[model samples]
Target: MRLMRIGEPGHERPVLASPEGRHHDLSSVTADIDGAFLAALADDPGLVPEPERLPETDIAGHRIGPPVARPSALLCIGQNYAAHAAESGAAPPEQPILFYKSPNTIVGPYDDVLIPRGSKKTDWEVELAVVIGRRASYLDSPADAAAHIAGYAVSNDVSERAFQLEESGGQWSKGKSCATFNPLGPVLVTADEAGDPQGMRLRSYVNGEPRQDSGTADMIFGVAHLVHHLSQYLVLEPGDIINTGTPQGVALSGRFPYLGDGDVMELEISGLGGQRSVCRPA
Candidate 1:
């Protein structure tokens, strides 16, 4: 099922995409697409009722809220892609490089991405995000990691490189936690709905010009390996999000120009759907 949260920002409601490709109200079953609701929906499909028809609202009329309403933690991996690491002048990580983005930074799909105050070198990163369904600990193998996954979504790991590196002295999270930095959603596609997350083709564009374009096949640390590695350090809970990492087409890559005000971004991964956002001055 392609589950989503719709409506206005704070008043968003739990909704499902009907077979007819329309949004069907699921408010009768749940309030929002947060942790507990997702965990319950993951366990019991019967709790949600089948709809004969979708709502009459325009598909484009509604705001696309974050696939999950509130995540316990927003974990991100740095340089998980070899090409991206090399482009940034860093060696491919010997271990999974981890960082945290506050949940407050998350915004809905199609929302405007803020350029962050005092920021001159803001950039975009299109990443494939993994949403955890079951609690995970020290996993024994990469094969077992897939079972813990609930679904997948498209995420923009927006960055302020100057603050991230030069100003902070170190630590990527400093530049990563600015407000409205993470634009997520369109939908949270269940693992069954998003077959082989590792094999999908992913692409991104800035102001209608292509910037980042690559496939999950290019990832240095695949999804299952990331899950297996991350669980060794922290307990993975349902609703925890891990941005697997972006490909090598960001502004930092120096192949394309960085973003400024009025720049729009569009990103898509095969079968998972597409998401677009506009960049504006903070």
Candidate 2:
């Protein structure tokens, strides 16, 4: 099932998009699509209620907010794609390289992406975003990781190279945590319906020109491994999102130009849908 939140910014209401492309109101079943709601649904699927029984909501004139609410943590795997690692001039790591972007960086998929002031090397990354459904502290094996995943969504892991590399003091969050840096969702496809996370074709474009174009199969550390590995070091709270890293063809490779005001960013993942964001001055 595809879950969505519709309305303006903070006023978004939960919605379930039917196979026929209809939006059914989910507010009566729950208040919002936040961590608590996701955890409850994970424990009791019936808590979502039946969309056929709920009122049909018209989302045409409204904005579609991020499928999941602001999460407790926004974790990311860096250079998980071998080609991307090569482009960044690094050897494929023996283990998953992890980092954190402030959770508040999340914005509606269609929202305006701010080009942080004094930023000149802003870039975009198209990644498969994994959403957690349960608290995972330490999983017994990578196979156990599937049970903890709530779903998947498309995420644009926006970055500023200058802040991330040059002025980071060896830490990346300062550049990664800029407001509106993470443009997430158009919809969140449940894990059951999302199929295998490692096969989806994810791509990105800037101002209508192709940029990143690769599939999740290129990821050095797949979703299950990343989750299992991370659980040993940090708790994966319900509603937490893990950006599985982007493939080759980002501006960071010096093959394309950095984003600028008035630029349009289009990102998509197979089955999960797409996001189109407009860039503007912060």
Candidate 3:
């Protein structure tokens, strides 16, 4: 199922997309798409009313918000793609390297990306974001990670290279936690609907010019392994989002210019939908 939230920012209503590509209001079933709703849907998808007889919403007329309500935690993995590691002048690590984005950074997919004050190295990263469905802690194996995931969504891990590299005191989150940094979804597809999480094609374009083009297959640490590894040290709760990192091709590599006012970014993942953001001065 492709679930979404539509309306103006902070006032979105939950919705479900039908097989025929129509949308139905899910407000009658749930107030918002969040941990509780995900847990309930796991038990009975029928908990969401059928769209056939319901009044269809004009999706194009409304703004699409992040598929889920504010997640409890916005976690990220760094250098999970070997090419990205190489571009950043690092070798692929044996284990997943983790980071955090303040939950406030979450924003709707099509929203404007703010270029923070005095910034000159804003960058783009197209990544596959994992949405957790069940609480998991200290899992025994990679196989168990599947049951804990609710679905996948396209994510742009927007970054500020200067703040991240030179001024961060070596902490990457310094550049990653700016407001509007993480543009999450146009839709959150169910795990059953998302197919193989590690095989999707991901791409990013700036002002209609290609920037990043790669596949999840390039990931050094796949989704299941990251989840399993993370569970060993931290509790993965329902509604927590994990950005699994990006493949190379960002401004930080010095191949493309950093984003500036009015520059637009477009990101997409094969089955997870896409995102577009226009840069604006903070």
Best candidate, TM-score: 2
lDDT of 3 by residue, 1-282 (tens): 899999998899998998788898887788999998887777776776668756688888788999989799999999999999999999998989999999889899999999999999999999999999888999999999998999999998999989998999979999999999999998999999999998899999999999889999999999999999999999988899999999999887878899999999999999888999999999
Q: Each candidate's lDDT (Cα)?
A: 0.86, 0.93, 0.92
Residues 77-101, candidate 1, lDDT per residue (tens digit)? 9998898999999999988899999
lDDT of 2 by residue, 171-262 (tens): 99988999999999999999999999989999888999998889998889999999999999999999999999999999999888899999
TM-score of each: 0.95, 0.99, 0.97
> After aligning candidate 2 to the native by TM-score, how far in Å is the CA of 126 from where it should be?
0.3
Ranking by lDDT: 2, 3, 1
Which of the two, 1 or 3, has more TM-score? 3
Off by over 4 Å in 1: 53-60
Quote the lDDT for 64 in model 1. 78
